[model samples]
Target: MSDDVSLMLRASRGDRKAFRSLVERHQQSVYNFFLRTTGHPEDAEDLTQQLFINLYRSAGRYKPTASFRTFMYRIASNLAVSFARSRHRRDGVSLDQMLDEGREPPRHRLHDDPAAGAEWSELEEAYLAALAELPADWRTAVELRVGRQLSYKEIAQVMGKSVSAVESILFRARERLAEKLEPFKE
Candidate 1:
């Protein structure tokens, strides 16, 4: 078995430092996943913390069948789905609205190169808007594939789907993004 597997085994046995090591190693990757999925730093912070908390509680059920990263991401993805569904059912607040609340309003930055800054700002707004228009599942796949740079296999593991399924999701997502951006591009 690998050293990480051993560390996870120790963590499963309630070794605090072992768990801490796992968190230290994986937190940024997990956080980036949440941030990209939700497009909100604040919600990502809450969800990432919740993911670790769930991990701690779930240690007893840990199995060595998959890599630790895959297992942790599966947990994170499930948590994100559950959180979104519950919030939607209970409060009618869409994830987009929550993310909007989390975003800082745009401010004009003083730039020596005004034309370049204007172009950048336009592109940023267009990209963000296009991303927002994608269906949730497709958006998640795109975020995991492009933003997080996870392989199709790793994304499938995280999403509890097959690699082919992940590929399909990413393909459809890219098509939708292209459609959404066509107007702005032209």
Candidate 2:
């Protein structure tokens, strides 16, 4: 059950060890995807756990037609969309409000930063904000393409779209990001 196909087969049949191995192999990538999509560490953690639970529940129906990663990501992406839509039904919760509420280290706190550190932090914040502002599809495409470094084909697979569609999303997303950062560069 070391190989993805075999592991999936076992997990599909209620093999806990196989499921654990699958989780170990892909949990970080799934978590990171959630973090980037939600822009909220706490939400990411919760979503990630839910993703695993969903995976386990769906394992019995798992098919080996594509790479396990692609299958897993498809589920994650769907769940993310559902979660966002659910949140939207309520009063719009800002990304900041949805993020983890954990306290930060004093040194990493913005007010404590030295000039260079402060500048870096500001740039990072701006970048993240820009990403958060993107349309959901574009943002998901960018995250999968750049953050996860998935190829256009892989992205298309995960998105259940064509390669051209994924490329178009990335192209539009990049243009929007550039526009957002233009003022900051000056």
Candidate 3:
């Protein structure tokens, strides 16, 4: 059994420390998944908290049928889709708004060159904007494959799609992203 499954089993048996360990182990990846999906740090933080809470509540129901990471991402995917829809109705916010306000942590300056840092920042911003413009399914597919480093089959399980469908989504998503980013190549 995987470490996550072991931790989850312990959590199911009311082991608070095991639960906490699981939370610590997976929180950053879950947060990053939401951050990239939602393009808002606050939303990502809230969603991450919600995901763990839901995981804890559902621990007793968890079976080791799938890898725990895949299972958690499936939950995250559903939550993110619901959150996006509700936020869309409530705020009518566009991806542009999210991108404009989304601030990434600064990378270490290369040779202490401010100009290089600024350029990289600008490119990063543009890349994010392009990502946000993708269809939600495509974005999710790409993020799972690239950011989360899931195998295609794993991504398929998370998205509840066939592997071929995931492949097609990723192919189209990559083509679109490349089109958007082509101008940035130096």
> Cα RMSD (Å) per model?
6.5, 6.5, 5.7
For residues 51-165, what per-residue lDDT tens digits would candidate 1 score against the true structure?
A: 9989988888888887776777788878766765565322234434534577422322323356754666544655655665556667677877787777899988889898999
Q: What is the TM-score ranking, best to worst?
A: 3, 2, 1
Which candidate number maximizes TM-score? 3
TM-score of every model? Answer: 0.76, 0.80, 0.81
For all candidates in order, the CA lDDT equals 0.71, 0.74, 0.80
Query: Tens digits of per-residue lDDT for model 2 on 57-163?
Result: 98878777767878788888888777776774222433334333432212222222266545554446556666776777787888888878888999899888999
Backbone clashes per model, in order?
0, 0, 0
- The superposed Cα distance between candidate 3 and the true structure at residue 37, in angstroms, equals 0.7
Model 1 lDDT vs. the true structure? Answer: 0.71
What 10-residue stretch in candidate 2 is worst by lDDT? Answer: 103-112
Q: Kindly report the root-mean-square deviation of model 3 from the true structure over all alpha carbons.
A: 5.7
Better of 1 and 3 by TM-score: 3
Which number leads on lDDT?
A: 3
Error of 3 at 181 (Å): 1.5
Model 3, position 90: C-alpha lDDT score? 26
